[model samples]
Target: MSTKTVRVLALVAFLASALVPAAGWAQQTLRIGELAGLTGGIAPYGVQIHNARLIAIDEINAKGGISVGGQKYKLDLVALDAGAPGEAVKVFERLLTVEKVTLILDGIYSSVEYALGPVLKSKKALLIWSGGNDPATTVGVPNAFRNHFDGGAPFMKVNELFLKKMGVKRVATYGQTGHADFKRFVEEYLPKIQGIEVVATEWHPFGEKDFFPVLTKLKGLKPDALIVHGFFTDGITMLKQAREIGLYPGPLWLNQYGAAPLMMDEASRAIWEGTYEILKSSWGVTTEAPERSRKFFQAYVKKFGERGFGAWAESGYDSVYILARAIEKAGVVDDPAKIGAAMQALNVPDVPELLMPYKPGKLFDKDRQAYPKIIVSQWKNGTFVPVFSDFGQ
Candidate 1:
C-alpha cells in the first residue's frame, strides 16, 4: 500500500478506537444544596455567599470539574430560600429527603441553625454553616462545620483589647431584643472579665424607630464606654441619635456588627469613626497571608464591581473553595462521611483567597470544629484595617 493510504487507515483506526465509551462513563452528578435567605433580613450576606459559591463552582467546572477515582463529575447547585426558621426547617427537610443532596451549604440565622440542628443530626447530612455563630451549634454535632468565627469569643477578645487595654472600666450595653445569642454572650461572657463593670443593659424591640429613650436612659448611667450590638440600620440610627443627644462625643463608642463595609460608607464614616470591631479576616494584608489572597481580591474586583467585599464576604468566598478542595481530596461525591473526613484533613499551606492567617491544625480541631483567632479591627480613615494580631507586632 502507498504511504499516504496507510497513514489515512491508521488515523481512521485511532478515531474508531476513540469512539468507544470508557468504563463507568455515565456517573451521576454530585449535588450541593444551599439554603439561603435571598429576600429576608440577612439577604445581603446570603446573596453574597451564594454568588461566591457559584463563582467557585463555575471555576471548578471550567477546569473540567473534579476527578474522583478515574471518573469526572460536575457539581449541581440547588439553592432554596428560607425566610424564617420554620421555613428554613421545611426547606432543609425537603433538600435532604426529596432533593437527596449529597452535601448542604447554608447560612441561615442562628435561630434557624438551632431549629434545624436536630433534623440535620438525624438525617446525617453534612452541613457547612456560614451565618450561625452560636457555640451551641458546634458543641455536639458531628456532621456540621461552621465557617464563620464564633461571635461570643470575638466579643470577649474585643472587650479585652479595647476596654481593658484602653482603661475603659465602666460600660453600658444596648442591643435588640431578639438577639439572644448576642445577649447571652454579653451577659454570660463579658462579665467574666476582671474590672469591667456593666452599669446598665437595655434591649429594644427590633425595628423600633426611635432610640432617644434608650439613649437617654443609657446616658443617665454615665458609663465610661458605650457598647452597641445590633443590625446595621439599627446601629446607625442609634449612633446618630446618640450623637444628637451628646452621648457619644466623649465616651468610647464601640460596635460589633456595624463595622462591616456596607455600614461604613461616606455618611456613616463620621459616625463610626474610631469604633473598634472584632473581625476574623480582611483583605489587603499581604504581610501575613499568601499571594493567593491578593490574587483572589484582584479577581473579585475585576469580576464584580468593588462595592461590598468585607470580612464576611471573604469568609463566604473561602468557605466554598475550601469545601471544593475537600471534595477533591476526599475522592467521593455521594458519601457524606468521606466528604467530612476530607474536610477535616484539609490544610492549606498558606492563607488563600478568603482565608486568614490561621494555623492548620489549630484553626480546626480533629472533629472539624473551627476555633479561629479574632483580630481587633478599627475603622481608620474610612477603611477596615486590622490593628490587633496575635501573630504580629
Candidate 2:
C-alpha cells in the first residue's frame, strides 16, 4: 500500500475512535426534585421520606437506570428544604428554575402542597406528593398528583368501622389547628356520617406539646370513642399526656399516624401500646403486607438500622418508581405533558414496583388523586398488628 493510502486509513481510525467516546458520553442525567422539610415541623417525616426516596433512586440506578428514547439516564436528586407553606413556593421555584427539574416528589405538609399549586401549574412541572387531602391540592391543579390517601373517604370508612365494629356511637374529635383536611373531616364528613354523634369538638395549635388541658376537657364529655388527628410527634405527645391524665385507655382511643416510625421508639412504646391507628395499607413493616412491600420494609430496616418505616415512606418510594416508569412510558424525558399523562394513566400491574396497595384501575382519578386502601392496626406490645384491611375508596 502507498504512504498516502496508509495516512488515509490512519485518519479514518482516529475519527472512529473519537466518535466512539462521544457516543459513550451521550448518556444524560435526569434530575428529580425533592422538595422536603429538612428542618422545622416537617423534618421528622420529611427526612424519612427523603431517605426512602434515596433507596429507590439507588436501586433504579443500580439496574442501569431508566430508559427513555433509547438513551439510559441515571436519576439525580436535587433536594431543598421547604418545611413551611411559604418556604415551599420559594424552594419549589428554585427546583424548577435553578435545578431545572420537571419531576418532583414533595413530602411535607398538605398546606405546602396547596400553596404550590399555582406555581406547579404555571411552571408546567409534574409533582407527586405523598399527603394532601384538600380538594384544591389536585382539583384545579392538573400538574399535581397525590400518590397517597386524600380527602375524607378513608376517614369516613374509619368512622363507620368504629361505629359498627367497636360499637361506639358518640365520638369526640381533637385535631390539629389550621390543618385543612382535619378541619374538613370534623366539619363536613363527620357530620354527614350516620349513627354517630360528635359530642364535642376541639382544636389544638400546630406544634403544641401541651394537650393536658384539651384532654381534660375532652374526657369530661365521656364519649365512647375519641378520634384524634395529627402528625406522629403530636400523636405521641397526646397519647402520653392522655395516658398520664387517665383519658385514653378507658375511651377506646383511635389516633391518626400513631403507628408512624417516629413513634416506635422506647419513649412512645408504652403509650402506643394498645392504641389504634387508621392509616394507609402496608404503611410499615408487617407480615401481612404484600411481598414487595415486605421486602421494601426489610430493605429500609436493613439500611436505616431498624428505626422502622411508615408515614409517607411507601408513597415516596412509589413516587420515584412512578416517575421512572412515566418517563419510560412517554418515551421521552423532556416533555412534561407526555410524562404527566403517562403518570396519570399508570395502574396496578403496570407499575409493579409500586408499594402502595392501590385498587385495580388507573392509579389516579380525573383530578390526579389516588385512593389507596386504608388499614386499621393496633399496636400490640411493641409492634403493629393488622386488625382490618381493604377499607378503600
Tens digits of per-residue lDDT, candidate 1, 1-393, equal 999999999999999979976668655467889987677666756666676677677777777776787777777789999779888999998898888885888856677888888887777678888766665776577788877666655546655666777788988888777676778866887787778888888888767789999898888888888777766667778888988998877677777662465424678766777776653444443233447666666666677655655555556666776677677788877778788888877665422444554545544565455555566667666666666644211
In model 2, the Cα lDDT at residue 118 comes to 78
Deviation in angstroms for 242 in model 1?
0.8
Name the 10 consecutive residues with the lowest summed lDDT in model 2: 279-288
Candidate 1 has a TM-score of 0.87
**Candidate 1's C-alpha lDDT?**
0.70
Give each model's clash number: 0, 0
Q: Given candidate 1, what's the lDDT at residue 232?
A: 63
Q: For model 1, name the residue pairs that clash.
A: none
Mind giving the per-residue lDDT tens digits that candidate 2 earns over 33-127? Answer: 98886787666667777888999998999998998887889999998988688878999989988888888888787789878987788887888
TM-score of each model, in listed order: 0.87, 0.92
Best by TM-score: 2
Overall lDDT per candidate, in order of appearance: 0.70, 0.78
Q: Please give the range of 10 consecutive residues that has the lowest summed lDDT in model 1.
A: 279-288
RMSD of 2: 2.7
